[model samples]
Target: MDAKQYANLIDKELQEMPLYVFYYTQQPNLSVTTIYQYLTEYRRFFNWLRETPKDIENPNAGSISDAKSNKEIKLETLKHLQASQVQMFLKELSIKQNKQSTRDSKKTINRTINALRSLFHYLTVTADLNDGEPYFYRNVMLKIPLIKGVKESISYRNAKFSPMLYTGEKKRKWIDFIENEYEHTISTRRRSSFLFNKERDLAIISLLLGSGIRVSELTRLNLKDVNLRDRSIIVLRKGDKKDAPLIADWAMPYLENYLKIRKQRYQPDKSEQALFLTKYAGKAKRIATNTVECFVSKYSTAFPDGNRTTPHKLRHSLGTELYDKSKDVMVVATQLGHTGISATDQYIQQTEVEKQRIQLDKTK
Candidate 1:
């Protein structure tokens, strides 16, 4: 829905309805996306506002006629709304201790309330009115506290490292298919595509399977970033400026081949120094993130077991296998450029029930 039109409709509702309230849309500091979100949250509240009990004393509310939709009312006048009204809105947000009347998630409620609070705070701080009390409006807005968010779901530490994808033989099948067995389909479009991208495709898969770098990181590579002789490429890591290890032994040959093809195709800096280039005519551009996803998805037929796999899952397979071999969380974490060990622990942990199944003897 168009935010401007929704805001306009809400303003119309406020004007036609029996309420004396002002709704402002201007927030100079906010981004366009942020402004859209604030408007959407306010729109939700305003949709339910007409049905909500009016605690605020409004003289104009009595004069307005009732409409089927609250959107019919137009709001022009500005009026003071008390903290009690804000509290009433919060109380109606949830039905039970765990359930919400608005059916909004706690995270969503918290965001909406923050948006409301931020707007009011902005108004309160910037208000020019000084009727012997400079802090009056600001104090009213300060009273609007954040709606407490619900706790997150249980951690993977207690749960089994569930749904571990494309490991062992499954991992081999995918690798083999990409490295040797992959082929174009009978369709004209399928056969025509990726002719110039064969080496590029293999290199992408090799990087994921060998180095386990993120799709984003792969897309961000430069021509100078690779070193085939060293069999390592410097990868930008999370948080710190330190480089992550590039152990793409299998990927080096593919990278060299792709680079050779890239150099020949995009001779004399035609690739514009991007490590990966699109197969476009004339001047080629850098590969896109969505394009990388499409690149990985093109060979889903590689999974002979009919199980689905993704690049991240391949990354997970690398981290998981590393942990399985060495049982070192920090090693896996550092390899993956994870900021914390807690985030890395999920790759190693198995639930009690799942572990018990593995413990069962084969003779039984």
Candidate 2:
């Protein structure tokens, strides 16, 4: 089939297939965005196949060709992908001479590999009996092994050896550090608008720190999700599941105050049911995730020690704090919407043993 026809067929198949069935049969908790991304990636692979030389005997292999010739190629094209080709791709990615950090490179490689794997897997399941199914086609691409140097750096970068939980004396110091720098400034039109919406910003920060919510989840929150009387918010956690829980005591007052100020600042349009809105935009629009990150970074800059501050840092801080307080692995996992306890345990295991030893010396 031609490229356009091929795409139309794929789209038709996707539309006919129930999304819920895909979730249940394949990735049960997959988000709609994730599924859509996989579909796009798979489409790109087929497009690439349509252009590339199909036969091993063809010396001019790897070159793009006309679509009409693609159908003449044998179905063995799907089964004959070499492990060496994948390795070459990885090598090219690693040495591409970009300014991206090691973490960014890792992310790019991981995403590309996942896209490739999804295409191959889809072919294995969907292709007809006449298609030549090779042995290697069944083996999913192995996860890239972390080099020792990369692994060690990532371990340290994630604060796998932090000295203290973010609570008690540490929490007090951090809070004092933040509050002291909280100058109520209205320097520019933008600043004035942000200042006018300060209460909402504060509430958002508090909730982030308290709940360990992802930025996307924070932006998607609506008024109906919050229960002021119960001091809880109904959040759509990962996998698009509704889960309600109590707001941390520290965050509740801030939210209440923000709601009061929000009522006075702008009239909510009929379509605007979101709890948080952009300060400069009309109340009909919700605040963007990047706006929330920018605000956090702005405040974080006020404190010299807050160099690593971002929306995600608040999540890490909460997880670290919870682990320190309760020492309950499952509790922390549930709070952070983790599917399992291994994620929470990593925080616990990463606690600096040397720091604990030093604290023991203080008692003497």
On TM-score, the candidate that comes out on top is: 2
The stretch of ten residues in a row with the least summed lDDT in candidate 2 is 16-25
| Candidate 2 residue pairs in backbone clash | none
Task: Predict model 2's lDDT versus the native.
Answer: 0.61
Q: How many clashes (backbone N, Cα, C below 3 Å) per candidate?
A: 16, 0
lDDT of 2 by residue, 1-364 (tens): 2223444655554653323223222544555455555655444444555654544468476543334443233335445555655555466666656445443376666666776665455455533333454223354354434323355543465554343234445554555554444554325666656556677778887888777787768888898898888777888887777777556888788788888877567666777777887644443467777788887777666554545467777777788778777878888888888888877765575444446679999998
| Model 1 quality (TM-score) | 0.59
Off by over 4 Å in 2: 1-29, 32-79, 98-104, 126-149, 153-186, 279-283, 350-355, 359-364
**Reference-based TM-score, model 2:** 0.71
lDDT of each: 0.60, 0.61
The candidate that wins on lDDT is: 2
- Give the distance in Å from residue 266's predicted Cα in candidate 2 to where it truly belongs: 3.7
